[model samples]
Target: MREWINLPELGMIGLRAKIDTGASTSCLHASDIQPFQRDGEDWVRFTAHLGTLVQRRHRCEAPLVTVKNIKSSTGHVQSRYVIRTDMTLGDRMWPVEFTLTCRKTMRYRVLLGSKALVTGQLVVNPALTYVQDKPVLLDISGAP
Candidate 1:
C-alpha cells in the first residue's frame, strides 16, 4: 500500500518509499548543493529536480548545528544535507532531517526513511499509488 504526500514548499506528490525502521533520517536526491552564510548565521541552499529539466530550489539556513557522516543503503559513505523540515503525509505533520544526495539512478528520487515514516501508517502494496492521484511531485525552479 502507498499514499500521496505534500511537502511544505513542493506541493502535492507521489513517491516510491521504503518504510525502513533501520534508517535514521530521510534522504532526498538533491544536486548542485552549496552552502553559504547570511547575517553571521549559516544556511545551505540547493536544487531538487524530481523529473524535469528545471530544478526546484530550496534554501535551509539555521544556526549551523551539525553535519553527520552517514552510509547509504547501497553501502556508500558520503556527506549529506541535514535539516529539520515539515513533512505532511495523510493528516499528520512532523519535523524531519533530510540529507541531500543524488538519486538519479534510483526509482524514487526521495527515500522515505523509517525516521520520517515512523509515526505515519504503513502501506506495503507496490501496486498502489498516491492519494487523489496527485501529479508526480516536482520542484521546477532551477531553469535558466
Candidate 2:
C-alpha cells in the first residue's frame, strides 16, 4: 500500500510517499557525491540537492558497495553506485538500495520503486495516501 517514508540518513524529516509498481530499481536525489574513506574502508558522502536554492542542502552518507551500469527511466544506459541505507516507511523499517543522482527536476527527492516494496507486505492504494500511524526512527546508533 502507499505509505509515508522518511530517509533519516538523508535527513528527510517529513515527506509523503507513493508506492510505485511501475519502476524496477528505486531512486533518490543526490549530488556533489564524493567517495571517500573512514577507518580504511570504502565510503561515500553526499548532499541531497533538493531545491534550486543552493543555500539549502542536506547531508547524506552511505557505504560504497559496488558500481554497476544500469539503464535510466528514459532507457539510456548509465553507470551508478549502489549504497545501502535504512528506510522507514510507515511501521516497516528495512535497508534498501538507492541510486544516487541529481533529481532537481523531479517533484520528490525520493521515489520508492518496486524492488523496495514488492514480494511482500505492501498493497498500494493510489487513490489514498495509505497512512500509517507510527513513530518512525532510524536505528543508526549501531549501523556500519
Candidate 3:
C-alpha cells in the first residue's frame, strides 16, 4: 500500500510514500548530511530530495535523535541519522521518527514503516493506494 503524506515541519508536502509494513523504522530521502552541534545539542543539516525524476531540493535542519545502525533490505548494516518531525496524512497530524538516508534509487522518496503506522493508528488496506487525501494544515499555535 502507498499514500501521499506531508512533513510540515520539514516543509515537505504531498510526497509519495510507500507504506511498508515489513520495516520497523520510517525513512526519508536526504543527502549532503552534516552533523553539528547547536547550543550544545546534537543537530543535523541536510538537503532533502523532493523526487527522483526532478532535482528539486529542500535544505532542512533538525535536532538529531540518534544514529542508528539499521540493516537494509539488501542485508547491509549502516548507521543512519534519525530525526523526529511532524507528519500529516489526510487530516491527521502526528509526530513521527524518521531515519534520513539517500533513497534516490528507490521509487518512493518516503517510506512509512510499521512503527509509524502503529503510532498513527493506521490500518493499511493493501488494496488501496493514496486512500487518504492530501493533508490540510491545521493551526495549533493557540493564538487566534
What does candidate 3's lDDT look like per residue over 106-133, in tens digits? 8998999999999999988998898887
Candidate 2 per-residue lDDT over residues 1-144, each given as its tens digit: 345667776567454454678877777777888889888988888886543344357887779878767777689998777787778766567887878877777666677888887733567777766577543454569442
TM-score of candidate 1 relative to the true fold: 0.68
Question: Higher TM-score: candidate 1 or 2?
Answer: 2
Give the per-residue lDDT of model 1 (tens digit) for 2-106: 444555644424444444456777777777777778887776776664643444445433333357688877998887667556666665667767777787776
Each prediction's TM-score versus the true structure: 0.68, 0.78, 0.91
What stretches of model 3 exceed 4 Å from their correct place? 136-144
Residue 19's lDDT in candidate 1: 44
How does candidate 3 fare on TM-score? 0.91
Model number with the top TM-score: 3
139: Cα error in model 1, Å: 18
